[model samples]
Target: MRPKIENITDLRGEISRLRVQRLEQEVELTKVTARLKARLHFPVLVYTKISDFFIELFGDDPEDLNKKKENKDWVTNILRVGLPLALNRFLFPRSGFLMKSVVAMVSQKAAKNVNKDSITGIIDKVTDWIKSSKEKSRKEPRMADYGIPPDSETY
Candidate 1:
């Protein structure tokens, strides 16, 4: 942020100061940028698109099952409270204090992503998968049993 210019003398002084400052800042920036570029030279950055962040942070898909319709009921309230507790207790019960704190913090953030609809959607997907698997098994026989007759060499 440059200071407001006033008189000619002040302006000239500011210009000289800024010129010196700019060169120093530019050198510093180049050094910092080089270090940053070296540290972040992984191809992960190249693979990621700007839309990925938007999609992850906020569901860009209209038909997203996780949050098609958010109902702010007792379930939602309970989820907000229970999710962090459950995650901390079940997943990271043996973790240290710092790990538990981090889990608690992460779960607290994640709780906002989940709701009644999301749970229902997960349940529905599981049930649908089970049904499809069962149906698939029932519909098709194995290669040996599909139409092949048994060998009778012993007989």
Candidate 2:
């Protein structure tokens, strides 16, 4: 004959453990849902579209530009340096409401630092810096001095 159990303690302990596991799973699920929602948000889509537009507008065909040679032109310069700086300025400001919404949804701390005035100031500074850098480069000797073919002849 087998001995019978008297107390319900074992069953109660198992129930509590299962409840804890379920709560953890729910918390994890909520986090994943929030991240997915943020990723699919409309502002992100708009931002991506704007970036694509700028790239298409300013960039040349990659196949035409030889990477081994230091080739610089106004269009290439604008596409490489100006576009990214402009996009960063455009996307992280309080004026960038959609971007702020996405950032806030993802991480509260990051959203705190994203505001309009500061981003505008930074944009101005970067613009000035790019202008100065371009001017400085123009003052330097030609690629012929460094043994690279002139950019025009290559293309």
Candidate 3:
């Protein structure tokens, strides 16, 4: 009877150990899944890619056309801010006027806030909104309300 009781105790300990191991494995799996999702859903790489495109298009070289400083600033800002904003609107259509109003208020607040950190946060939010919008847009096909442009071939 003593030996039998010892054996049962050992079996119960093993079962408990196995349960702990399984829980650890499950936690690790969750971490891995979360990391992968962060990689896919975040737009840090997308922002860099867009920035590079704009730089390549507008950055000056000795052999390139002489560009004005003000023009360059305008182009840079447009690409940095306007492109993402427009893309967001095109892709994720909330109420057009509502979006406009919110963006306008955010912009005004950012400009007036005068705090670097606040502005940075605001900009980040704007970029995220744009990225999400574009992702939504890419999933849908455009309607053919307007005729295709001349000098262009449709595939």
Candidate 4:
């Protein structure tokens, strides 16, 4: 009987030890799964530096309005725009320079067209209209004119 009881106690201890190990394995698996899920959801970001050598050679001086005006010619445009685009595509086939250049040009044109004074005038008009509407509402008693008591409440 004593030997049988000792064997049963040893089995129970082994079962408890196995349970602890299983729990530890489950925790590790969860951490690994979370890492894998994160990797799948968010790809790694890669940034490539564009060499300034070509820009320095072919690009126009940004501060020189005269050079910018001169670049409007077809020949200059081909040199400034066409060559860089072609070279970029040849060197880096997957580079997004075309889209970036188009967006930059469009935004620069839009910025040039925006009038600060016009925007300020519109804002002033809106504020004045709001103030006038509030004043008119306070000055006129619509409910009283309609024969409703000022203090009465209805829903």
lDDT of each: 0.76, 0.63, 0.65, 0.62
**Which candidate leads the pack in TM-score?**
1
Candidate 1 wrong stretches, greater than 4 Å: 1-71, 94-98, 139-155
Q: Give the clash count for each candidate.
A: 0, 0, 0, 0
Q: Which should have the higher lDDT, number 1 or number 2?
A: 1
**What TM-score does model 2 achieve against the real structure?**
0.27
By the TM-score metric, which is better: model 1 or model 3? 1
**Candidate order, lDDT descending:** 1, 3, 2, 4
Off by over 4 Å in 3: 1-19, 22-35, 38-44, 55-94, 97-113, 116-155
What TM-score would you give candidate 1 relative to the actual structure? 0.37
Q: Which ten residues in a row have the lowest lDDT in candidate 1?
A: 65-74
What is candidate 4's lDDT per residue for 62-130, written digit by digit as tens? 566465565354444444555545655675566586765764455444444334455578899999999
lDDT of 1 by residue, 1-155 (tens): 77888899999999899899999999999999998888787655754665477567775685563453454556666766887789878988888999977876677666666667888999999999999998887955547655546664455
Q: What's the TM-score of each model vs. the native?
A: 0.37, 0.27, 0.26, 0.27
- Choose 1 or 4, whichever is better by lDDT: 1
CA RMSD per model (angstroms):
23.6, 21.6, 24.7, 16.5
After aligning candidate 1 to the native by TM-score, how far in Å is the CA of 45 from where it should be? 44
